[model samples]
Target: MTPTQIAALIVAGAFVLLVVLLAIPLVKLGRTLDEATVAIRKAHENTDPIFTGANSTLTHVNTQLERVDGITANAKTVSGNVSALSSLFTATLGGPLVKTAAFSYGVSKALRARRKRKEEPWGKHSRRKGGRK
Candidate 1:
C-alpha cells in the first residue's frame, strides 16, 4: 500500500478504538438508568397504600375535629348561660346580701361591746388594787 493509504488506515483504526471505548460506558449508563426506573416504579407501588392509609387517617381526624367543634360550641353556650345567670343574681340580690352581711356584723360588734361593758361593771376601772389587773 502507499504511505498515505497506510496512514489513513491507521487513523481509521484509532477512530474505531475510540468508538468502542465510548460505547462501553454508554451501554453501562443505559443499564444504570433502567435500574433507576425500576426502583422508582417499585417505590411508587409501595407508596400507594401509604397514601391511602394517610387519607383515611386524615378523614378520621377531621371527623374527630368536627365532634370537638360541636362540644366547644356547647361549652360556649353553657358559659354564656352561666355568665347571664351570674349577672342576674348580682343584679337581683348582691347589694341586699352585702347590706345584710354588714348589718349582721354591726349587730355582732354592738352585742360584744355591751357584753364587755357588763363584765367590766365600773366603766373602764378594774376592781383590782392600783389598776394593775
Candidate 2:
C-alpha cells in the first residue's frame, strides 16, 4: 500500500474506535436520565396523596376546634347561670337561716347556765373523793 493511503486508513480506524468509546458512555447516560424521569414521576404521584391527606386532616382539626369553641361558650353560660342560682339561693334563705341560728345559740347558752347554777350553789362547797380540806 502507499504510505499516504495507509495513514488515512489508520486515522479512520482511530475515529471509529473513539466513536465507539463515546457511544458507550452516551447510552449509559441516556438510561440514567430515563430512570431519573421515572423516579420523578413516581414521587409526584406519591406526594399527591400525602398533600390530600394533610388537607383533609387540617379540615377535620378545624372542625374539632370549632366544636371546642362552642363547648367553651356553653360552659361559660352555664357557669354564669350557676352563679346566678347561687345568688338567688342566698338571697332567698340567708336572713331566715341567720335568725334561726341566732335563736338556737341563745337557747343553748341559757340552758348551759342553768345547769351550772344547779351543780354549784353560791353558799356551799362540795368535798372530793380524794382530798383533804
Candidate 3:
C-alpha cells in the first residue's frame, strides 16, 4: 500500500525474472559441457590403439638402433686391430724386404752390363769390316 513497499516488490520481482532467464542458459551450458566431456573421452579411447602401436614401433626402432650401435662399435674395434696389425707387419717385414729387392735389382743390372760388354767386341769387328769395303 505504501510507495516504498511497492518499489521493493517490483525490484524483487525483477530479480526473480533475471534469475529465471539466466538459469535456462546455465542448464544448456552444463549439458553442452557434459557432451564435450563424453566426446573427448571417446576420442581418447579410439586413439589408444594407435598410440600403443606407435609406442611399439618406437621400441623396435630403439632396439634396432642399439644393434646398429653394437655393429659400429665392433667395426671400430676391428679397424683398430687391423691398423695395429698392419703397423706390426710393416715394422717387421718392410726393412728386409726393401733391402732384398734392392740387392736383387743391383745384381740383375750388373749381369746385364756384363752381357752388353761381351757383345761390344763383335759389334766393333762388324763395323770395321763394313768400312773396308
Candidate 4:
C-alpha cells in the first residue's frame, strides 16, 4: 500500500477503538440512572401516608388558630365594654360624692368654731382691749 493510504487506515481504526471504549462507560451511566429513578419512586410511595398525616395535622392547627382568633376578638370587645362602664361610673357617681364630702367637712369646721366662740367669757371688744380698758 502507499504511505498515504496506510495512514488513513490507521486513523479509521483508532476512531473505531475510541468509540468502543466510550460506549462501555455510557451504558454503565444509563443503568445507574435507571436504578436511581426506581429508588426515588419507591421512596415517594413509602412516604405518601406521612404526607397525608402532615396535611391533616396542618388543617387541625389552622382550625384551632381560627378559634383562638375569635376568642381574642371577643375579649377585646369585653375589655372595651368594661372601660366604658368604668368611665360612666366615674362621671355619674364620683363627682357628686366628692362634692358632698367637701361640703360635710366645711360644715363640721364651722360648727366647731361656733362652739369655741360661745364658750369664751368676753366680748370681742373686751378681748381686743387686753382685758382692761
Best by TM-score: 1
- Output the TM-score of candidate 4: 0.63
Error of 4 at 28 (Å): 2.5
Candidate 2 weakest ten by summed lDDT: 123-132
- Residue 112's lDDT within candidate 4 is 77
Model 2, 24-118: lDDT tens digits are 99999999999999999999999989999999999999999999999999999999999999898889988888899999999999998778766
Candidate 4 lDDT, tens digit per residue, 1-133? 9999999999999999999999999999999999999999999998989999999999999999999999999999999999999999989998998899999999999997777767763656234556533
lDDT values, one for every candidate: 0.93, 0.90, 0.91, 0.90
Error of 1 at 8 (Å): 1.2
**Best of the candidates, lDDT:** 1
Cα-based lDDT at residue 46, candidate 1: 100
Expressed as tens digits, the lDDT of each residue in 16-117 for candidate 1 is 999999999999999999999999999999999999999999999999999999999999999999999999999999999999999999999999988986
Cα displacement (Å) at residue 100, model 1: 0.7
Model 2: what TM-score?
0.57
RMSD of 3: 5.7
Clashing pairs in 1: none
Between candidates 1 and 4, the one scoring higher on lDDT is 1
The TM-score values for the models, in the order shown, are 0.88, 0.57, 0.63, 0.63
Using alpha carbons, what is the TM-score of model 3? Answer: 0.63
* Candidate 2 vs candidate 3, TM-score winner: 3
Error in Å for residue 33 of model 4: 1.0
